[model samples]
Target: MTDSVGFDFARLSPRDRYKLLIGTVVPRPIAWVTTVDPEGRPNAAPYSFFNCLSADPAIVALGIEFRPDGAPKDTGRNIRASGCFTVNIVSDALVEAMNVCAVPFPPEVDELERAGLALVPGVAVASPRIAAAPAALECRLHSFLEIGNSREIVLGEVVHAHLRADAVDDRLHVDPAVLDAVGRMGGHGYARTRDRFDLPTMSLAEFTARTDASDA
Candidate 1:
């Protein structure tokens, strides 16, 4: 057996814990979130600590960190004020643009425009969707959990989804090859979804048959 190393999270500093977690989590999905302030100024930011949690309610969760000075980030504030936001899937083609959106721009700055990205009006929410995104999820604020003073977990229930016409078939199965989504790795690293494989689950009877044939 290979040797193993472990660190007790309770004894580690937040930064150290973050490094360990992000480093070992492999490629996490990126949520290119878009929201509009009360004044209608659009904001865009990319967060890797995000995922879909519940399909029955179509809930998605985003882990947003508070600013170092202890203020909520623009995206968090905007979502609280507007009660809505849109999550745009970052594709290989949009990786650079997504990075641009991650810049520490002032709240007044329109990151989408700064990144030279286009937006489409949300059908069910006021927040706009990235026009070039392969997929966009329109969501309404379902709940918010304040974790300590440094982080927050935002739960948004997806009300609608928009997919590139070519990416989805009649039965709504998305073609991963067409989507070409990008994911966040540790630090400055990123990963592509192009390399993939499939393994189907075997039933108990099939497993037994396989074992019997192997013994024979």
Candidate 2:
């Protein structure tokens, strides 16, 4: 027997559908994105709807939402205008600063400065990155996707990356404990990535052998 209910997305309101998606998506990666306004003023913002879309081309995607008036947010508008952005990893230590950047500020205000964060110039892009971030990816606009009047998806090809020397190794493996990155949850919630366990994938022979052994 099962106890399950279904809410058809087609019949639900956008707000309700969004609530369901965010609530059920578990923890989502946070993109501490940095961009420059048309006049070259730096801007920093955080988005939970972001992830690495492809590794072959090293591409990342950011799903940016518009304002209540249907105006593009600073990050999306800046990316559309400049064709470049930087994504900084939000570690536990940087969570407060990342949240400060999320506040709605005027176009002239520099969110990075307000958060009192240090910055470093991007190696391959005009946008800068947070100096204290565990990792940062400099990206150029690859494409844009307009799902509706409410959201815009920005696909960017990562041209360069900077990793903390103490966190990443020459073999390119990252120590999760050292990185201590944070993630976003539904509504005003966040989660830490420190708690993790590994379960290796088994081959078919190994699976069959384990199953047979268990049956005995």
Candidate 3:
């Protein structure tokens, strides 16, 4: 005998549905973003619900949420003011600094300075990228998507990219091992890309040939 269990989200509350979503998502990539305020102070934050939205347009997205009183976060405000931002890929080596950048400091405070992170000037934008980040994408705001009361999605077009010289090839193939990227898990947890393997697909003719050779 066996038993099965399922939860009907339609009947459940929104908060419950959110819990299920985040719990089941397991690991999500973190985008360590940097933007400059109107006064030119740098702001940084880590967002897990972020990913590339389009390749042709070279767009990336970050899902941001407002505070309880519906105030926009520093990231959103900075992006609106400057129209540009830099996204640095989080790595295991930079996790501690990345967490420090996540602190909700006052608008006048520069999070990068607070976190003791060094910065390099972005090629296509005024925003600076984390000096130790394995890779950085410089972007300009393309559009904004309002999902609900608290959630706002910002889509940005990639204007420039910088990768550690040894991590990429002449053809721009990035070596996963060199990146050492880390991902966010549910509730103060993270995962590393250290455990990975690649499997190549075989053609039908190759499979048939192998089968014939085995019988012989």
Q: What is the C-alpha lDDT of each candidate?
A: 0.95, 0.94, 0.90
Question: lDDT score, residue 83, model 2?
Answer: 95
Kindly report which residue stretches of model 3 are placed more than 4 angstroms away from their true locations once superposed: 1-4, 201-216
TM-score of each: 0.97, 0.98, 0.89
Tens-digit lDDT track of model 3 for 1-216: 699779999899978887777778978889999998888888899999899878998999999888778999999989988999999999899999999988887788777887889999889999999999999999999988988887799999999999999999999899988999998887788999999998878899999999999999
Question: Which sections of candidate 2 miss by over 4 Å?
Answer: none
lDDT of 1 by residue, 101-175 (tens): 999999877888989999899999999999999999999999999878889999999999999999999998999
Clash count, one per candidate: 0, 0, 0
Pairwise TM-score winner, candidates 1 and 3: 1
Error of 2 at 88 (Å): 0.5
**Candidate 3 accuracy as TM-score:** 0.89
Worst 10 residues of 1 by lDDT: 105-114
Estimate the lDDT of model 3.
Answer: 0.90
Task: Please state the error at residue 65 of candidate 1 in Å.
Answer: 0.7
> What digit string (tens of lDDT, one per residue) describes model 2 on residues 121-191?
88899999999999999999999998999899999999999988998888999898888999989988899
